[model samples]
Target: MSFQWTFLATFLYCELIVVIILLLPFISPRIWQKFFNSRLAKAFAAGAKYYFNFIICVFGLLFLDSIRELRKYANIDSKDLSAPHAEAHARMKQFRSQRNFYIAGFALFLWFVIKRLINLLVACAREMSAAAEAHKQAEGATRHLEGVMAKDPTKIDPREIIASPNNPPRYVEAKEHEFEIKKYKQEISKAKEDIDTLRKEYEQSMKKYNELQDEHQKSQIQLAKLSDNESSKDK
Candidate 1:
């Protein structure tokens, strides 16, 4: 085999190994996800699309060449077949071309399959992680609701807040309404307190203004009296 063909065969073997490893039952999606997310994998993934496309194109060209060669050899001249050595050589060429065709074709097919399997495993891992987080949140909420119910059983029932085995909608509209009403009441009370504080401040400001006015009036009267006495003394 030529160097290029040998390289292709090696690549095909590597792909086959990878597919086998991926299909192994003991290897979980989580492990695959971690490997794919690693720094080394990320660096490769950055150019993986272009790299895979280049490889596919090369394999496609090789496959086409193999097909052409196979067809060329299949139509060997009758003169060539008359010679036994020539016939055997032509047959050998045809077999090699056939082998190359299968190699390139399988390699190309396996490339797509490997890409798809990796994507599926990564997606599965992410979905599993999300599901676990959701379950944790649900459990925490259930525990909190249980605590709240323990304090005030009449206010909220556990069944009304938490979903049952059938996964019914948690009917908390009444509880939400009550909470809103209580919040509004607190806001109204706060507004009233602010209004009372403002009213007291306004009253104090008016009192101060009145005191200043009285002082100004008394000063004006004293100035007038002093002016009249000075005028009398001059007279």
Candidate 2:
């Protein structure tokens, strides 16, 4: 081969390698996700991915080396395809075929990795959201329990106004009661704020409920009118 022919072949091979690398990411997204999600699979995929890259690099270097040899041969004697040259040519041709096969396989793997990863992420998000919602409901229930304890009539809950005529001012008990009263007052303020917020939410929900009821009534009236029209038509 001439120097120009050798250069053209090298350029074409490099282009082919680039195209294969670019396609791998899109084709193996799911495979990547699955592999990355588990520790064992992640390790395996990392090793495999690196090995694949290494093999591609080796092939690329070999291709370049072969092209350089071809250029050297062309420079020395353009027409000779003798023993050593023929052997080199055969190896280069074999490498090209093997490279194509590797490219196709890697592309499939890449696609699989990406798809699996996306699914895992969506599942994880849904689980996290459900957990958060449950926590919020539990916290609300706890706050309501605390408020009920603060206001129970029978239970001499230390948190409320426990004023009695006989226990006018025993200094120790008075101080303890003062502290409890202060704590309950703070809780009361917080509960009031919550009640205001809930009132607004209830009002909005009631407004929507009334709107739906009105819509239902309208729909009933329309249905009755249609029935009457049909009855008249029959008559």
Candidate 3:
């Protein structure tokens, strides 16, 4: 469970990194001025260059065109600040490819998760329903056998053999009884397995949700720090 949560957290981190990279052009310059004297701006400029280049390389042709456009916007914004626009511009010129890979990928992944949950719930419900139906069938069979026996004469009767254990109803080898028990056991086991699977998925999802919450808090803190630092500089 712990290992699974760790892997989920790592996946969440990659997702965040991708989102931040995609938003870099729109967010970075607004947070930092173009002036060379601004230390944070220089770091931001360097990171922007490295980050976009890295995206072009790693994501390759799949995200080429969208990335190029993004890089172009970032370059113009960088130029407004007298930052290294040429490097970003040059990369966009060199690599001409485009895809909204992240948006599509994220959406597909979400759809998959939703689809899986829907499938699991539907299957579980069916299993439980089958189990209930089996129980009803078995009860009905037993009740029928009891009624047949009660109608028989407890003393001497036409079909009742005095020495026979299953005298009248003779249910021990009845095909219906065997069938009922077999069907009930099978359905009940299936229902139990489905219930266990549902529980595991719920637990994993809960853990993932908690990890996401922690990551969100950390990002909020970082944003707060940026705001505080800006304010303190003015003061």
lDDT values of the candidates? 0.87, 0.61, 0.56
Q: Which candidate is the best by lDDT?
A: 1
Positional deviation of residue 8's Cα in model 1 after best superposition, in angstroms: 1.0
Judging by lDDT, tell me the better candidate of 2 and 3: 2
**For residues 1-235, what per-residue lDDT tens digits would candidate 1 score against the true structure?**
9987898899999999999999998998999999999999999999999998998899889888878877877676878888759888888898888888888889889999999999999999999999999997788667767768687654455455567688676665667599898999999999999999999999999999999999999999999999999999999
- Give candidate 3's root-mean-square deviation (CA, Å): 36.6
Which residue runs does candidate 2 get wrong by more than 4 Å? 1-84, 152-235
lDDT of 1 at 135: 100
Give the Å error, residue 3, model 3.
Answer: 79
Worst 10 residues of 2 by lDDT: 153-162
Off by over 4 Å in 3: 1-175
- Worst window of 10 by summed lDDT in candidate 1: 152-161
Stretches of candidate 1 off by over 4 Å are 144-235
Q: lDDT by residue for model 2 over 117-153, one digit each (tens)?
A: 5555557556766888999777766665666678643
Ranking by lDDT: 1, 2, 3
Better structure of 1 and 2 per lDDT: 1
TM-score per candidate, chains pooled: 0.61, 0.30, 0.28
